[model samples]
Target chain A: MTDSAVMVEAKGLRKVFKGRRGDHTVAVDDLTLTCRAGEVFGLLGPNGAGKTTSLRMLSTVYRPTEGVATIDGHDVTSDPESVRKSIGFLSGNTGLYPRLTAREVLTYFGRLYGMDDGAIEARIAHLAQLLDMDFLEKRCDKMSTGMKQKVNIARTVIHDPAVLVLDEPTAGLDVLAARTIVDFVKDCRTRGKCVIFSTHIMHEVERLCDRLAVIHKGRMQFDGTLEQMRATHGHDLEDAFISVLEAA
Target chain B: MNARRVMVIAKKEFKDVLRDRRTLIFMVLLPLLVMPVMFLGIAKFAQEQQSKKQSRTLRVAVDSNVEPMITALADQWMAENSPRLMITSAKIGLSFPAAGGDRKGLGTMIEQVRDMMDGGADAASLADLDPDLVESGVRLAREIDPADKALFDDASTISTFRTKTEFILIEDLEPSETRLPAGVEVPDDLPESWDGEQLARAIQDKTIHAAIHLPSNVFDMLEDQRASVPFSVFYDESVSLSEEASDRLAAFARIVGNGLLEMRLADNGLAPQFAEPIVFEGADMATPSRRVQAFLGGLLPYMIIMFSFFGAFYPSLDLTAGEKERFTMETLLLAPVSRMELAAGKFVVVFVAAVVAAVLATTSLGLTFTQGILPQGVAAGFDIQFEPEAVMLTAVLLIPVSALFAAVLLGVALLARSFKEAQSYTAPLQFIVILPAMAAMLPDLEAELHLAWIPFLNVSMLMRELLKGNYLWDFFGITMLSMGLLTLLTIWGASLIFRRETVILRT
Candidate 1:
């Protein structure tokens, strides 16, 4: 991916959440980043490190506390609906209605995204095939967690959004199920979709992300390619992550 | 912005709500089943109480001198008024001995009689106080003691005595002690002063339904021409049934008084008609429907309005605060549909629930009146029939009322962080609606233009008037217009709340 193909830009993106104890906690501070088309960008952080908060801002689920974010040249805050229409969001805890079947959940979301009935059905079939979800025909509650996650992913992309924001998308899956998500993200990146994923797993970041940022305590500690990060810090990415945290 | 998106959200919400077993039971099944069971239970309870009260017998203790007079009067009264009243008396021992009787023996006999009446003395001791001694003691006690004048002047003593007597009547008497054969409850205390204003006040206070004061010389008064006897009755205005019973007793008294007068005149060989020249006829103009409407009008509206709050309660909580708690609100907000569309979609569900509950409650009430849930002859004179068109119009009026309820509840519920918090906030709303809704049941409230604009009160009045087959177009129009305007305002307010992301995602 070239610089000219960058589809998402976050410049000095900051989010300071006000705590109930009359103190301000910096969720994301002075963070600047960019993601090119056809590139998978992974944000690595421990819990409460502003990864999800930043992703939420990028997806227009939340307005940034400060700074600017744009998706496909549309400002997240000012043109939120347009940005929302352009991005598909998925998260581990994000759920499908347990009462609605996989098809029904997809169709409902498809309609919400303003897709026609024929288009919604076609997209459901296509995504179901891509995710290997043909066996799941009942309500989400009756399905395995992995099956439900597949349905979740299908619902997220049913509208064929140009950008995808996934927060710990494979946080709870077994080996094969996690591989399915990793492979899906690679496919999305290959299809020229800009994907920003948040996860704590070093292997997922090593295996999938082309460019990455390591955020610790709401500040980006590292922003570079994998080889560049390894060469600068250490041979092992996991050890390098520990060294950065220790040095901070 | 698309209609399809709203429908999708609504359909998903419906499915989600229905799948929640607790909510499904509360929303749909509860209203369907609770009404019939509740009404039938209440009706059965009322019938049981009435039957129990009718079958109950009261016991009375009478002095011997008063016994002869009271017995004859009671017997005549009972004979004249059958099924409603029955009287039997127990001989009461007096506090003093009769003139020319053994003073010590009378005192001992009276003490024994008191103990026996209280179930403390042995049967052998009670058998020793002969009937003649007990009778003489009763007659002697009737003669007022001059020495007791000073004691009667002491207010504290009098009050204490009265209190003690009241306690004895309430606590010490056996269940069968006051057997009147029928269920006539003779008041524990009867007024002696006979002041008209006091009697009226007592009646207003529900102290005595009717007090029969036998003049000291009632027989002599009947024999002489210019002797006038006065009897006072006290009843509560709030107890309409008691007032009706009192009126019947007064009419019977008047008939007996006239009979006595005719007998006196006939003994002098003059015609009974000469004693009474005027006759009057009495008629009650209130129809059965009007009477039934008066009762049911107030209750129905209060119930409908109050129940509308409950109908909107869970959905409002689930759709707003519950969604926030479940962490699904953020996703919903991210949907392309505007906040107004989301609010409208949720408001539709809650409003439908409210309207259905209101319609069901009103329909159940109508069934109660029509299907003889009450005694056949209790409200028999009232002809209350709900016209389909009238009911439909009322339901139309309720649509706005329900919308207003749903919108207000949703807006308030959204302000809370959790379902429990929302419930705490919204529970008092029922009381707020119930009080004013019950105002239409007030007897003197005529359908006035100004009153028609009052929230809840107007609906109650119109429903009552409509049930009585009185269509006041001006009142109906004003009420509908007021309710509509209020509902629109509330909806606008709810929309405003819906737009606030802070409130929408409060948790």
Candidate 2:
């Protein structure tokens, strides 16, 4: 889509946490990955397989114990504020303020992003209509799981951020709600926006991922297209996913 | 450190906290109503119980022969003691008296009534008196000495005098028929001449709340030249009715005893003044307001400091650990705001809550005094004068105290993974201030150099001193400095914790 297209790059990212008893757990280790504008990148891993940890490092939510990542042209560590302004991040661990109405949640973030009231109001209107969020005035705590997910999705993109990093955003959503997120991810890619999504769902990886990375045990196991993974590892995508885990 | 961003964050927190019904209850309404209602309630309740106690009728019994004698004693005591008090000459002299219905101020009438009670005419010369001179009659009565009975001879005709102690003397019943109230017992062996045991049983059973026991042939024993009479008085100490009855009966004995001694002294040509050498005088100089302020000082500062701690408690938890619990903290951190800005925003909400609570408590107390809401006796003793400058200085001290509270609470609460865990951690914090805050409330704890450096104690003590109209400038400077240092250190520490991904993402 663009002559120069790389939007995110991670090189040798490492994160180690010291446990309460002084044991060390390496959450992410020496992982290298990249995603470009107009690309839907899938980070596939099981629970605690460094998928969320890597994404957190990329989003600047956590600092790398070693190495670095950059969003667009800004280094995440050196220019975190700019990096933050560029990326919309969502995960199972991130949620809406229940006491705040959906509209309030959006407006608050918009203000934090240095948006004027007029711009925030207009953007809220557009997102409300686009997301089918008729319950925007309802408090986040009052919403059903599906409705709450929609509010979360609206909050993630309220600033119209250029890069979207989603960590299992649809993990527990109903079918229709999951479809809304899937459509939104595809829509983000269609508008030449960069997307890095992590999930355990194989079907989701098959239907939406353009290029993928498999991380296991705090290390990247594979990084390539699904067809290339299938050719090298196994025929079935699920089998290839499991084989990669086993080999690791 | 964008002001607008910090302001935006602060405004948002205010909205969220204010909308929380529980927060508003502690922050706004409690401070507005508690003191006034509680003091007024206590005053009214105490007044009611007192009136009830004074008007109560107590059951009494005596040896059948003693009833008429006791009745005669009551009348004779009144007749002997109602002295002939002379009214001092005043400016407004009337020809014998004023018109039939001349109006006088209640103060003037009360003054005249007081003169009559002290040993003046039955009808006082109700001329305008210098209120100061009206009090001098007590001095005059003491100086004249009752030995000179002629000095108190009544000069003006007035209404009849009245005695203060009024009692309904029920007819005497037999020792057995005068049943004890409930839990009473008599000794098995009893003396025939002085059955003090039966009298004790009568009082214990509460059948007769009070009783006087006389010896058999007691009149003959008394009439004998050198013999003495032995008898006993019985009453339950715990029963007010019984206690009051004993007091009145004791008074009659005292009057009769004194009359005997005086008559003996006169027969020997001596004066009673030989035994009564000391003239006692008592003066109270404290105004009502100062008394109330001194009393309140020992208690209110503790409450205010405790409330300031509470004001920071929930909010700091809700914003830090609470965010982690709600899953919203990460979302907030992801926004392009610094941890300090976030911390500052949280700090503002809690500080406002603390200051608002303190101000409201002060306002409530001020209203309680100014509104005349206490019962008459209590109100008469109160004259609270709030110095505006002192209050303003006290407010300055609240700043660092509240800041330290917010920062320390937020920093500690952020370490927890949930609201309940945060609560346990913060609860012990309330205890940390307990010793120091209460130390300031101790009336004898003077503001010393060493105490000025102890953080919470210093603030509490400084606030207390400021409230009492003492500036303690050097102590104030040091306390503010120490508090400022503590606040900065706490804020820095909180910012450090805010920067920690381990704490922010504890769950």
Candidate 3:
């Protein structure tokens, strides 16, 4: 934490969702964290563990309940448009219009980010080549899940933003597609982009993440590196995760 | 906010809408083909039914007392008319006594008459009249005027004796009413020399087609001067062939009247021209073209306005609820363009589709009237001409109408949670549009200055008057301003909806 240059910083971040009958559900309890440029930050949690809510707040899709979050020096609450411009977001269930071809889809997003025609075309072609999405020139509705996943990945990076927030990005992908996504995350980190990825798969954390936070029942239970976690709770990452949850 | 980004969004929306088979079918193919097919099918069916009705011969039962007179009338009518009229004599039952019946029996008879007039009796099983009963009143009328060779000259004498006479005439009657027996009612004020028109109208209220009245001097008139007697024939108007039958009977009466006049004039050593001093020349102001144009004027605007609703329907749903259902809306929201730009881009697609549909519908209606579907005489009479400039102006007017419709529909559809829900939301919109769109159909509704500023009604009325070759510039200006303001209002409303996160995220 001391060595890493902060790319994302939050102080006392909280989120409350209003429910039916005038009740409120605390989705994220008072939590604070930081992720640095050129490092992978993992928000490891079980289902409904407030991971997606926090990610949404960071992406500026939702505002923080009590405090503030800043992405690349832009406040999430006041400068949401700027924060949105700085980040590329993807979720496993984030959908693409089935009617458009992969290239058209990417070009659409690139232009929305105010990219000129030449840049958009160039970006689409480059991403299509890299992600092997050229085959997705056919209708998207006819594409296999892995093919759709690749197209989704290409769409996310088309704007070349400084930060990437992925929510369970590999939740349903086959092995080959999952590997491609993991590799893309590593490549994003290498490009000096701040990457915060949320996942429940422990192997994903063990392989790619540099620092990790474990949250449960809307509260943070652990916050440290994989080695620090191993040093405190034994070598097995899965067992340590389970131990942390059990203790909490 | 960038133009390039907006254009990109527009292009993508177009692709998405076109790729959807249902949207494509609804927006383009259905309207393009369905209207012509529906119109032509209805027209063909109507023509076939008319031809069938004209060619078929109807069998009408007549009372035996008036059998000879009716046969003569029918013969003369059939000879003069194109469609053949066939008459069959059958005895209709009369429960009334030969002279004066008991009061209770008369009441029962009147009740039976009422039932028969109310369309209760079967036509096939009607009772035959007694031959002696049939000729009793006719014989009585003849017996009163033996010596006076000029009894027909005394009009009051016939009126006096008609109260006592039971003789009747039935002509050109509906089969449904042929089951009723005659001579049941002699309402005291009924004129002895009445024609059938007033009687026919009265009987029509009770479902009776025709009844006959015979004056006492009818036989005298026939014998002494060979003159036509004054008699009445009554019939109902709502019977299927009543109009044709009424026309036939009127023609027969006119011929008989002319013949009687001619006979009397000849006997008095005068000419028929002396009786009719003046000739009437009828002039009709409407040309064939004007008639056709009037009908087209009413129809064209309605069709154009209706197409606007249909054209807006699918794209509105597709852009909003359809995208939401497919899970692509979040992706769209994540794009760097502002919400307003996305809304505007979608609005453009729907607006274009609506305008195109409207134009096509108007063109089809115009072609239907001009392309030989209507008779040349009718087309010529109507002078059904629309200038190219007027059409262009109407097209310009449609832009605002289309815009207003598209924006309103898009806003409403965005609030819906699914395609079916959006359809439910927009279905009543057609009802909202239809009445105002049909302004031209009501010719009595004049296009007032204030009405010129009403939303859909103004466009409808203005288009109608414009197509009729009228250019009401003040009305036109008001319509343009009104439509423009309404369009802006709707677009603004749609923008507000776009800004509502709750509406956009409604699941």
Per-model TM-score, in order, reads 0.72, 0.78, 0.73
Tell me the tens digit of each residue's lDDT in model 1 across A128-165.
78888885569887988788878877878888988898
Winner on DockQ between 1 and 3 is: 3
Ranked by DockQ from best down, the candidates are: 2, 3, 1
At residue A35, give the lDDT of candidate 3: 89
Model 2, span B244-281: residue lDDT tens: 66764554355445545555566679898865788788
Q: lDDT per residue, candidate 1, B17-82, as tens digits?
A: 767776665566666556666767776788877656444432222223443454445444333322
Model 2: per-residue Cα lDDT at residue A163: 93
Superposed by TM-score, candidate 3 places the C-alpha of residue A33 at a distance from the truth, in angstroms, of 3.2
Encode model 3's per-residue lDDT on B143-196: one tens digit a residue. Answer: 333333143234233342232221121211221234332212222233334335
* Candidate chain B TM-scores, in order: 0.64, 0.66, 0.68
lDDT of 2 by residue, A19-50 (tens): 98999999999999889998889999988899
lDDT for B455 in candidate 1 is: 86
Give the top-scoring candidate (TM-score).
2
Q: Report the candidate with higher DockQ, 2 versus 3.
A: 2
Write down the TM-score for model 1: 0.72
